[model samples]
Target chain A: MEPGYDLPAMIGMTEADVQTPALILDLDALEANIARMAAEARAMGVALRPHAKMHKSADIALMQIAAGAVGVCCQKVSEAEALVRAGVGDVLISNELRDGVKLARLARLAGRAQVAVCVDDAGGVAELAAAVAEAGTGVRVLVEVDVGAARCGVAPGAAAVPLAQAILAAPGLTFGGLQAYHGGAQHLRTEAERAGAIADVVGKVRQTLAALEAAGIAVPCVTGAGTGSFRHEGASGVYTEMQCGSYAFMDADYGRNLDAGGAWTSPFRNAMFMLAGVMSKTRPGHAVCDAGLKVMSMESGLPVSAREGVEYVGASDEHGTLADPGDVLRPGDRLRLIPGHCDPTVNLHDWYVGIRGGVVECLWPVTARGKHF
Target chain B: MEPGYDLPAMIGMTEADVQTPALILDLDALEANIARMAAEARAMGVALRPHAKMHKSADIALMQIAAGAVGVCCQKVSEAEALVRAGVGDVLISNELRDGVKLARLARLAGRAQVAVCVDDAGGVAELAAAVAEAGTGVRVLVEVDVGAARCGVAPGAAAVPLAQAILAAPGLTFGGLQAYHGGAQHLRTEAERAGAIADVVGKVRQTLAALEAAGIAVPCVTGAGTGSFRHEGASGVYTEMQCGSYAFMDADYGRNLDAGGAWTSPFRNAMFMLAGVMSKTRPGHAVCDAGLKVMSMESGLPVSAREGVEYVGASDEHGTLADPGDVLRPGDRLRLIPGHCDPTVNLHDWYVGIRGGVVECLWPVTARGKHF
Candidate 1:
């Protein structure tokens, strides 16, 4: 219950000396992911603004920047503020802001970093403008165009022009570019389907860019793309920036995506892992672990046991049931779990005990882990 | 963003001044829920050990204790630790523990409070005993019987008797009782199914209790039951404590459960609301809000708009789309969203901006919000 009992001290050694159900980050794998994405973006001549929404840790953002990412994209103003405070120079809030209090916070963030936000409405543009004006700061604005994800964003092409115009007209706000992120296309399992999805997205972005050009407006940055479809977006000339987030922590869901050769070849290595301890084996064919629905995200799917011969079958609020391996797993067995969805799963924890070379390197606070607003 | 800002600095202010996308806890409704549950427990003559996994807040646990609950059940050791540190006297960790580190933590927890834990294996009993012996504390251990959930817990009847005996045989661990909680039964939809599910659970408990009694072992407590079927467990004469977590904050999923009259009647009032603002209204039929999958949990389903004529149809990582309430919603319009799942949704926030009478009265830290150990 007293959380700060250093795991190393309690266990009489370092983190590497500890067993499973611990959140471990392969620094090498993480760096490789960052480098690969950066190289891809550099080759494609697109800005690489990695989404901080995926990690929510400033440490990761700094690493992304160091790997030549243009900037970081934050989903919430609070997240942006946290990143900026952590010395992230540029942050694009790839989501709209309506609350005046949040808008004011956005303006403050703009003072510290190169702040840009996405707007899908004329009123949102005006509000951003007003907040920027009130704070006496210059903030950039992007018109969010709905490509295929019918979740947010305005209709593509001409519809986005007016919002861009409003943002341009608003005092203290500059028309930054377009946010053409098709979130749904990112998880299309098959390569052809993913390509087709992004192809449609690219066509929509092209039309939007043409419409803006016709209106005598320049789109400086058309940012969109996730780890799953970054290749498609990178190939498409319309997308100026790729907003890939999950490439850092490749999960089982993303790992299912097929490559061009019709074989499963994940571009990124699995870097994130949840270490769990076997809590119970009172049953003959099952052993219960200490991680469950609350510890891991079951939205995408249940976590796959990293160890061979172990199958994760069920989860309760606090306990996860693992199918018994042929060998007996007693109460003290440690299990490593590769989360199905890394983003939300990370959100469920307070600290990321960063382990490297089997040692407790550091514990990074999930600073924006629960920043819903 | 720097979260603490204007927006009517006190609770019970007009809705116009409240911040959007803030967690609003209706104290009046919460008190009513506590009272109603307490009254029901009193009437049924069952000890109510409300689960802290729902709120994960010590303040709420204290409130439940004040409302005449015997103790509180937590899903994780970290949560139990937090509650015990906050002065929650009788704490039951309704989950298994495998690692010596957690067992040590649990043992330390027993020093301050009446600590009871569930075990489904002999190895778990040994670990608990070792930790308790090391700490020089007597920790109570409950043999978790697998009623029907098949998630955790050992098999009922004879299978549970050995685990019970193991706990009793342990050096520093005392045989507390049996845990026969069926989580999946909580959302059975109809009253009959819910009752049937509890009946099945009760049968399993009866068998296990009989097995223990036949072996000349006295089962001190038979704790089980949830918000969905506490009444059934209470009436079954098999359970001593009811661990219902969600009665404090009834959600859309719970709202689907039917009463004896075959009418959908939620036992508790909807006390938790996610106050979100319409960030975009460029389209005719849709309005985008700043709250989405990352803010609100979508595992159960989309959050239902409290206001009539508005539907939360979809969500992106950071934006929730509300079907436009024709001619009523603008870009800055504030809306209250009743999350589909209150527990996970609440876990996604750091501060519960408790508002009363439309004003922000208190900002309580979700103390164990991300305690995913």
Candidate 2:
């Protein structure tokens, strides 16, 4: 659905044309964020492969590419398919794949885009090799190294070399470099802690690179870094591609991260908000809004009211109760809520209704919103 | 999408023939549950209007109607629209509406089905009345009484009367009875606590009913109750409708509720499971699966491994890490995961692939999966 196409026209326009419980993206803030990240990557001479998992919209992926991003990284094969269908030429799935159906989907996707995937085990390599061999297509395989996340990925250093060799020995797989990512360290709260975490990651990457070199293998791409630790990874001279996703639409969680100046300056501004309306104000201190647990993700924390002197206290399936409204908030009052987390919150909506200057400027379908499989 | 369609045919089986991690519904268990609830409602001599919000599918609504349920209750206008499109004749949105666009949508939906909506304030009533008048359709408006949920709905007793009178005075709106639902009481750990909470709710509903009767306003339909306290509400002589959606696909959270035998017996059996394969298991004491926070909702809690001896501990975007997998997991091993919460977990998937007896049987597209509006 395009902007103003399937949606109901604004019945009565207000200061903000759309009603509450609407997903709103600040286009100016978003562009500035893309430019800032692109400039940082350009300065460091490292390729910026922005992760599309954060926004999950092809329109934003195109904007990132237009801003000189090398490619967009997708977490799921379906996401990669959606991006490729949207005309993204270069795509890399930074997550491991083992399902045969998904591998076949990836092989089909590789026909249209420069598709690469991460692998931490021999079984995954064998599966990818089989799929690629059957399709008679070349797919890049990156050996993911465990930096600190303790999730997927093999151990760094000597353990990663065998995985790389296995990928090179596979029938139709190309040996891409390491995916050394520490997801936990990205939200370390302080610059020193983030830098310390990244330093440890850089040491692991160095060890893996030395092991590959000793074995007479050229490591092509060492890609890893998020919006929180992209600068550290870029300055380390290890990673060739930085996969930062949240830099496009910063949320309240990112706003808490500190910068080098120690003045709590976020690299990006809060650009996404769920516009909700005050549906009922029967009580004196509380007013219920249309947005709730269904509308916003409550994993990080509850959404903070963007308006002054208002706070979100609780949420149900269909309604969010706001606390301590300074004035009597009648029904139809629009409120902008800054989500605690952006990624999961964006996944909850079907459309990203872009609002600029209070008019319905554009609407972009969240093509990968419910692509869980 | 139906059973034995697309993927199921490719897998060469019916829904009853698929392996575990595939969502399965025992026809016997489901029919027994429907019959049990209908018998309870018939014994109580009250209308059984089951809520469609639990299972956003119209197939379940049709079954509820066949089991002697008067109508189905919906949480959103979009859900009601989908239900009506799927042939549900009568529907009620159990939430307040303030947006004119949504109200217009509701009025349009009323044209196809017997539509009713809850109102908590005068502004909502006025907008709904105007929408109904403009659409040239009569919509039943229920005055929602805040029966301890502390969410939407007006204060009990006289405060609800004015809203009821306003609905009566509206051009194309009829005043339905009070909506006295206590959502918080549904999840009470003990039967005694749940019954006690329902008792308090009954008092409030009685006050509202008496006030309306004294004012000579007809209270045609008094609806409220969830799966947790439906039995108590059915016997209370106040609530005429039971809105229980999760009974169709019982989850781990619901399994915690104690049964009538003084033992831990789930009221509804576990029917839904997320089938995920072990993506990486080369590490000791840990194995990662393809299902994660994106695939399954973790808000209620992490999904429990259906097989004995395996425990789910950590999750990332596309991976669920299982710890202490005592000889039950390896790469290529498939496991069924019982989700912590059924609603949000169901919303994550695009298709509910139903498998039974070790074969892929059916694939139901989650038609209203991401319908947040």
Candidate 3:
């Protein structure tokens, strides 16, 4: 299968002239976000490993690496393969690798690049070690401690010891560190809630590290944190690397998070937008845009209109009904939508059209897109 | 961008040997669905124009066409382009075409196949007329009527006549009647609600046709309906064509609709399944699968596990938490998920692996996948 869109049609066109349902990236805002996160990480004396799973593009990953990122963190083996294929180094699979086919690919990638993966099961450790030995490659293994996400990873403290020891016992695997991503805390809304969540995560990390030390298991690094609570993790002295993904494309959901003063406190501006065209205005109350659930991620929530006053009301499979009260939009009129979640929304499109001053400056192929397996 | 998984890694592999996070299609179930729909349409004496937007695969479209379909209805011009490019002829853009680039491409496609598109505006009619004339091809026009969906289309009765007249006035265009799809009626829990919704749709369609006939416009065809309400529209005397998609890949949401007897009455069995592998079972209550929102469509609802007693609980970006109470499933166990909505779920993957007797039989590329423009 080939991606239908090879190159962008918005090269010489203005932002208004660009095609509908295109992923538009504001380079200025993106650069500002990259710089902001890098500066924050540097000040906190922690290495930044921006989550490549959020963007799924090596171009953005390279940009972050160029701006002082230690590496990129992916959730899938195929994602790691795609990023490494694009010449990125020091890639980490932040999630578990159990499928033999994927583990074999990860082993192959580990031979070429500095590859690391998280493991929560001691039983699966031997399986991964076999694949690593088959490929004649060394893979760094991280013992993932369940830090309140309740999704993946072992329980904190003593529960991580067996997994770390299993990795240490394996010939082709090195017991690297721990992955303590408090995923549920990322979007806790209030700064206190987010701070409290991270505080709990910090306590768990300390507990786990102390338990591992009691068992005479030396841990090198501890990686965890998303864009929503990266500040707390960066400030924590125990966290060595912060894995913030959506810092570059601060979406509507993250934009809704409040600070200590109860105001939206995202340091990043909206760098990502899904461009849609008003396809119909015949209806009295609402106008339909060409983009909807197929292109935009509605997991967090529906997209918000970039223009003020116009509200995104409803959506079908292929159309978004905008509540156009003043009839400001009509057929052929273009609009930008701030997606609720940037990662899944980015997964829907093939190219990210970078727009600056209403002109298309860069187009990056979502190289790892649709690499679900 | 080139697709990462260019071909099936499960050609000779058994169901157990197939890779994780793959789309597995039951060929027997799919064939049964196609035959059932075709039989239903034939018995009702209405032409079947299965909506290509659901599958977006030319291969499946060809199978649909081969199984006694008149043609296929696509929600986008780019989907039609990809389908027609793959040799499936007689394509209809079921949605409105207003964008110039898309319209021009649609016109160019009209020169190759029996092409038609929907239009609800007079201004867009003139624009499409220019493109159709430039391409020197006959493009049929369906004046979509707002038959209670409230999303797109001009109002029924007197409102749609002018648009139908506009299409007739344009050169290289033929008035292809009305597209009155009650998309909202498809998921009404009870059969009476669906029947009532279609009755209302039929009334509006009749009113619009009466207005068109009063203006001396002869209607050639009326296309509408989907997997849920196709029986209602097909039985309606006014509807000439049924645009039923998702029949071949019955999803969980569609499976929820009750029949006249208040039973799960879809003649189509669950043909489409999203295959996910158990990556972690370290947690006592729930196990995490490799597939989540990134691969599956959770908009309608969470996926139902195919195995008895196994329930889908929660999801993250890369992990789906499955509540495996009986411990029947563990790490490396493959589970089939009945997707919430098949269309968007199909949009996430690249290939569809056909399984028969628990053996890999057919592998079809989701050729038009991600043709969102």
Candidate 4:
């Protein structure tokens, strides 16, 4: 019933001409981040399975695959479906699913591509096996060991053995490995802190591996890591696959992470930005931009302005109040905003206006933008 | 390219069978909220203009209009376009637009609907008028006065007079009244605090009105109020139109606002919920649900669990950690989550599964979702 809402910008339009509240991707920066991550994973002797949950764009996922990523990791069945349908061959759902409908979808998706899912419970394994048997497809299953995230998965060591055994015995399912990602360790602020957190995570993963080895089951892969702690996990010897997502589109939160020397110098650069327009500038020392909670998420923190002398102070539903000390911002002026968090903020937009050399290069649809099933 | 991503649930399906991470709208509670808000507005002697930005659903906006709302308010040009194309005849963009492309779109949308927009600057008025003239349509224009909201709008008093006069002089534009919204006053916690905040807003609005009157300008309407402080603004007599959006879908943040007796006795009930499944329950005293920052915005705060003895403690990208001291929640179990904020949370979903008597009655498309021009 709805029409006439055009895309934010034309491909050849200048960055200044693009509409406000549009998600902009620096093409050069994104490519550099992808290449760097792929090289780093190769150098560290770990398979790179960049998380697709961050960008949720099939085009970006295909790019990572072309750059030598083994596959991509998604957190939801719907996301995997979106990517696989868009020609992605291998996808690993790095999280667990308990719903039968979702498991059925996952099994059906396995008929099309190489699909692997994580499980931490017997009920989940049973449901998944039923779906896969009904679909007549063999789906890879991984035992999710808690490892330090404490958010999901079975306990560290022996508790995962039964889950792995269940997967091995279930019809139309194969035990892939262990899903041991520690999500909490990704953003520990300091290099020492993140390294320490991953060290603990590696210990838990090793214990789980030893238990599985005792059970005479060979683990194919141990997938986990994030932008903050990927270096530690990549060198941990226990992790065989890295699922770093936000390294592709570094945000203000990741930019705040301290390096080994306690400096903010990181190999990755900010690639994603929210281009906002100054909608109202009537008040002195303050201006309102067209990007706020609706266009950018603020759970981690407020967006950081890319321009000097302007600070994004507060965000309402549709308006971001900027602290313009010099009152230089005027009506219709555009500003680039680095979101606090990449994944959730990227989820808020439909199209990523890819730009390079101050001009829009492409408009990639966030293929799985709202695929939250 | 995605062919397998089906709707979360079909019509007539049971609520328990609906997919996790789906946005559920309790139909009974939603209708009651709409009717009550309409009745309250009638009793308060003010026109109801429910903000469509909250739900972004054309179906919900139509229901509000059927219940006696004069029109609906939006915050973006594309949102107005979406609703207008979906048969919403009258739309008022409650916020300012500075980009020429968006203004042009807004002007064209006015050709198909009764469209009005707010402006706080001379340049905005000029650009809007030009677009309206180019489109050969007359558009209503409102002078937004900063009424205690430091985010946007011109200064409170005599500053509005020149802007209103400018609107009157511009071609294809008719000066409507003032757009004085105190967004920060909406969530003042206690009734006394909210009442005090709105009192200040009313005073500023009155000053602006007096200035406009002294300048021999007549204001046809004054629209701006929200769910939290609507009662105060409704009784102010200066605000002729109330723009309360969250009353139809109360959130955890609004649920925390206290009444006049310093108790949590709100007239509105929460009709909206995020139905998530317990994906992992391996750890004692803790469980992880399949809803997180992707499905729900946590800027205001984390979502409050609808079940007793289960508390939502933390959120990651795709998992919500619940503190289940009793360990009653198990894998595949469902929990209804009341999001901290309603507007942005609703934007994260594609469809609203409307339930009544524990069955899916309707699937409403969030028509204007992500239409952030």
* Chain A vs native chain A, TM-score per candidate: 0.95, 0.95, 0.97, 0.98
Mark the regions of model 3 whose C-alpha exceeds 4 Å error after superposition. Answer: A1-6, B1-8
lDDT of 2 by residue, B1-373 (tens): 2222123222435432332223444445566677777887798887888877666777778988999998898877877887788889998888888776778888988888899999988888888888888889999889999999998888778887888889888889988888888888877878888889999999999998888888888898788987788888888877777777677677777777775566333546676777777777767788888777676667677888887889989877667889954656777677778888778776665566644555654556565666666
TM-score of each: 0.95, 0.94, 0.98, 0.98
Better of 1 and 3 by TM-score: 3
Instruction: Kindly list the per-residue Cα lDDT of model 3 for residues B194-271, writing each as its tens digit.
Output: 889999999999999899889898999999998888878888899999998988898999879998675554488999
lDDT of 4 by residue, B1-373 (tens): 1223658888888888888888999999999999999999999999999999999999999999999999999999888988998999999999898877888888888889999999988888889989998889999999888888877888888998888889989889999899999888888898889889999999999999899999999999999999998988999989999999999999999988888675543678899999999998886799999999999989889999999999999998888999999999989999999999999999888899999999989988999989888
Candidate order, lDDT descending: 4, 3, 1, 2
Give the alpha carbon lDDT tens digit for every residue of A124-223 in model 2: 8888989888888889999999898888888888888888889888877999899888888878899899999999999989998999999989999999
Clash counts per candidate, in order, are 17, 17, 0, 0
Output the lDDT of residue A254, model 3.
88
Q: B-chain TM-score, every candidate?
A: 0.95, 0.92, 0.97, 0.98
What's the TM for model 3?
0.98
Candidate 2 residue B167 C-alpha distance from true site, Å: 2.1
Model 2 ranges with Cα > 4 A deviation? A1-15, A260-265, B1-28, B259-265
Comparing 2 with 4 on TM-score, the higher-scoring candidate is 4
Model 3: per-residue Cα lDDT over A1-373, one tens digit each: 1123334454657887677778999999999999999999999999999999899999999999999999999988878888888989999999887877788888888888999998888778988999999999999999888999988888888998888888988999999899999888989999889999999999999999999999999999999998888878988889999999998998999878998876554578999999899888886667999998999879899998988778998877899999988878879888999999898888888889999988988778898997776
